[model samples]
Target: MRKLYVWDPLVRAFHWALVAGLILNMFVTNPGKTAHRWLGYGVLTLIALRLVWGLIGPKFARFRSFPPDPAAALDHAREIVTGRVHPHEGHSPLGALMVYNLLASCLIIGLTGWMLTTLTWFGVEWVEDLHKAFVTWVQLCAVLHIAAVIFESRRLRVNLPKSMVTGYKTLP
Candidate 1:
């Protein structure tokens, strides 16, 4: 067993903060419109920060390390199907997909949420519906992501939950 500092401080901070904001935004955005608006703004800010961090962050956080490689990702997917999961220093193929999806979906979700609060869109049914719809999509994706994390963590004997908190993963 070897120790690997995969997730850095900034990355960990961004991860937890974003999760909190997303959950809080979901609740606040519905009942308390004003709190919802602020939460949405916070989400937008977090997304922007993550974009920059992905570019300039540490080894595992950088985009260059996990840029979508369809072929390799597919191979990893195949391996997973065959019950040979591997914990490659950073996010595995499907995990990478979830990462990308989370960022993109959150961006769209946050943007739509913000749009609904604008002057011209006030009390607009369609905009609100679209925003709500995106939230549902995000919610579903989040659930799947968590399940995948738990599965992978168990299979690999990795402390993924703790790693995210401590910015360290003891590689197997």
Candidate 2:
């Protein structure tokens, strides 16, 4: 196995912070409450920081390194079906799609949550429904992301979750 520095410190911090924020908002804080609203704002701030970091951060953290590409993701899926062992130093193609999806979902959820706090959109049923829907969507995506990470780690002989925590990947 070869150890490589992959995830940077900012990337790891952003990942874990987002995880905490999502968990707090989704399960601990009641929707429409002050705590929920504040957590949503915190998530929005994290997303904004991640967007800027994706522009100017390290090579693996950059948007150019893992641009969302459906075709590439599909190819990756094919590779998985065929049991190919191609290890990406950064986010894999499917992983990139998930990152994009989660970022967009969190942004929409934050916007809708903020809308609910404004006088104009307060008590608006559709806005509330949209926020709830996105919360569910994000939760589902989180499950999928975790499962994929575990599966890929075993399949590729790389400790993917460990890499996110330690900023190093032990790749086979």
Candidate 3:
């Protein structure tokens, strides 16, 4: 199998770190103040780092490569539906959309969460509910992201989960 170093080191690191932080921050409910704050900070840092990485990274990792362009994204999606096996070198259409959605939603989640900690917004019941709702949406997006990965891996006959772990994908 041909091999390619598609994802940069920082991108892969940020991806896994965010995954861990989000997962831990999701299930651990003993929000004894410090733990909750630390988790939010961790997520914020991960997102910030990812933003930097995307700006100055390799071809596939660059924001220019994956910015949400509706026509192209939709055409690629249509190609996939029409059974055209394109030699896709970077993020696929649906994957790109998912990435954008996750990024925007997570930013909102982090902002609202951090806002809740501010003295000005402290004890605001609506902010609390908003944070909780965004967290739930984050979890749902994560699950859907995984399912998409699994489906794409199977369709492409590539072990994408392992590729993310190893930062390498065997090419066509």
In what order do the candidates fall by lDDT, top score first? 2, 1, 3
Cα lDDT listed for each candidate: 0.83, 0.94, 0.80
lDDT of 2 by residue, 73-131 (tens): 99999989999999988899999999999999999999999999999999999998999
Residue 132, candidate 1: how far off, in angstroms? Answer: 1.0
Determine the C-alpha RMSD for candidate 1 after optimal superposition of all C-alphas. 1.6
lDDT of 2 at 18: 97
lDDT agreement of model 2 with the native = 0.94
Of the two candidates 2 and 3, the one with more favorable lDDT, higher being better, is 2
Candidate 3 lDDT tens digits, 13-91: 8888888878777787444377877887888888887788788878998888888888888887787688765646678
Best by TM-score: 2
Candidate 1 minimal-lDDT segment of 10 residues: 25-34
lDDT winner between candidates 1 and 3: 1
Top lDDT hit: 2
Runs with alpha carbons beyond 4 Å of true place in candidate 2: none
